[model samples]
Target: MNISRRALCGVALLAAVNPLGIHALASPSAPKIRVGVLKFGTVNWELDTIKHNKFDAANGIEVEVVYFAGEDATNVAMLAGDLDVIVSDWLWVSRQRSEGEDLTLAPYSTAVGAIMVKNVSPIRGIPDLVGKKIGVAGGSLDKSWLLIQGLARRDHGIDLGKEGDVVFGAPPLLSEKALSGELDAVLNFWHFCARLEANGFRRLIGADDAAKALGASGPVSALGYVFREKWADENPDAAMSFVKASAQAKKLLDESDAEWRRLAPVVRAEGGELEVLRDRYREGIPKRPLAEEERDAAKLYEILAELGGEKLVGEARQMAPGTFWAALKT
Candidate 1:
């Protein structure tokens, strides 16, 4: 397999502005942190790399990981007292809080999602989606897709709740149906999106552009690190340590090219063309969480509350007063 020019350019761009520091791996520590994550994507890569390379260990921390195929599985495990940390979407935290589900926004992970449709589908834009059937990965915490739909509803005065106007399904079905021309669109996470595109599905719109249209100031992040409320309350020190360690990993990628290349595949796996996946990794992942971006999360919550026909926005206290660990510095 050969790398794309865009991927090559992406690698070069990342090398020029490496803000996440990639230092020498740290030594192993005891009582490893247990984290449950979605399987075999960029996020899985990050968690696995951190565990295998002893990135947490180097910082005097230990990490244990569990993998699941879907966000619902991770949420179910978290609710069952089986996980210390889980990687999920930010909007999910808000919706969960609004519904009185117990969880907290631990940290921002990544800000991207993708919309896939048959390469020849008539759906060319958001407005084109009226009366069309679309699929979403059921129980996916990646609410950016829903957020985009909500924004479209608000801005265009359209209603998706009406029968036959919109439909939702899991990622596998989304892929299968779209390929078979049974769907107008499918919303999926990053790596899945890349694979779908490679399979000839055209991207109708992406979270990045959707966020902007909805008035987001900077790039929007979707996935976040979340911890159960009880677990966090009992393990504040561990929580802080976890936050700091993850931030350090982000910093490593921000600063070191050699480190980014080594870690990029952990996010996006390429069969043989490592460069293409590496390029996608560099451009797609956010180096670290930003506090200022919490406003977007807040805004997303407000939108969901309205769409969900709720009275009050969920508690802000649930989200860490500081969005990212480093933000607490000021």
Candidate 2:
């Protein structure tokens, strides 16, 4: 996840058109907006739906969906101006803003993650995770991991990083390790956690549950759509259009299981995997953006800042004002 500038430059040099045959670059005659995305994330499904349904064309813009392997690649692309927008955590957006980068975030999904264990395991709750081998998806600095650390410290007076043998790996590998008994529990991203649940794993605690224990008023979404302030200022209509289109896609996802079935091929999900993803998507789809004044948002920020330390959000303990794009409120 530590992407040096030179490495990013190399990636840019080697970047190619999307292999899926979706347009890699927008037409010059139209407003061209390049969006960086991960092939397996929820934004991938939403963007694919938009493209397949001609939503961008209907909105008077040409969107080139650029695929990235991870957040590092996407961050590099966006900073290099190869991408106009990206779906990322609000914490990243806040960090960028702290460094004087003009970034704004809008809600994507409020789906928080979960701690999953085998159904037969003796681990019944967060307290039981003490002295356990827990597999973490993503690095030690991951927001969810940080939040869980905070939860552990507050709820049971235990420092999870000190008490538990935490192994960091990719979601798939974490799932594999947890299922095979190599790890006692796995703190995974929502999608993989859903898959584990579908395979009969039981959730010890979800993100929302942890957040509430740490004093959040309601659910908090870690992911959102991030864009540069200058770009939004210059292309106001395009920005609004993109948000509207994404909102439409979210609505479709929220309203119809049939839509999930239709999108399975596009999302590259199959059989029971498709059903699992559908359920996860339904659980994650945000009803609306989190309000800046809400207690939930404030408490969530506090937890992240306190637990994540300087590694996550720079030296700032508070989220930069205007980090949330209020234009989307309309």
Candidate 3:
């Protein structure tokens, strides 16, 4: 095994600048936070901004991104002590904590999808959806699905799931079906819905609106940066620094149109689709305080639990203690 001077120097420089201070490595300069994200997730947009602008370094932390194929894979990696943080919903974080695993969420995107119909479709609202062929992405336990069901039941006096000829499929597949007129309406994830909108799909009701209709304060966070609470406590500086960097990245993205154009290829969107994505991403940013968000989540938890049952919410009927990781001050 031969090591060249350049390679050796590179390794030395890495060790010198990194101060992760836990599990993977020890360094004195600045702590490194290993962040696991979906390979093509929207979170990458913000992370890309952070890395491109050196926000992590400016905030006194170094970010190491590890891409995963799926959310479940990242969850396994987190529990196996292979990652420091990952983007996930508070629902999963609450479930993990309830089961004694001690996972916590830092508010990220509040973005959620909508029930969309082709512009010419007769379906205009929840009541109109009765007996219509509706496609749902992300299966039965998807929070948006359950929230819509709850809203339908509350406002329209119908088990919307039962009333509609519901079909469950992946987001992309459903989006295509809706676009081709194979489905009357479709409930898909945010990005998929954005694309559909760009292609002339009309939203019947957004998930955020459903949450509000069902008594949530406003749009609650659908996803966040999740971490092991014990690990976060041990590395408070790193944890807080990463949070600050994420906020800075989001702020930059919120204000810069040029940045959106720069990230076009990364998102695989352009023209109207790109514009829609940028707008949706900005809409999804968590603007409310932690307390307000947590409170809204608590309210939504009850409705979701009623509609989705033990499968969606696990044994815990509540949102679980420490689900929001609020103690780590931003």
Regions of candidate 2 where Cα sits further than 4 Å from its true position? 1-29, 292-295
lDDT of 2 by residue, 158-193 (tens): 898988988899888889888888999999988888
| lDDT (0 to 1) per candidate | 0.60, 0.76, 0.84
By TM-score, the best candidate is: 3
TM-score list, all predictions: 0.70, 0.87, 0.90
Error of 3 at 110 (Å): 0.9
Report RMSD (Å) for each prediction in the order shown.
8.9, 9.0, 7.1
Arrange candidates by TM-score, highest first: which order? 3, 2, 1
Name the candidate that leads on lDDT. 3
Q: Please report the TM-score between candidate 3 and the true structure.
A: 0.90
- Which residue runs of candidate 3 sit more than 4 Å off their true CA positions? 1-28, 328-330
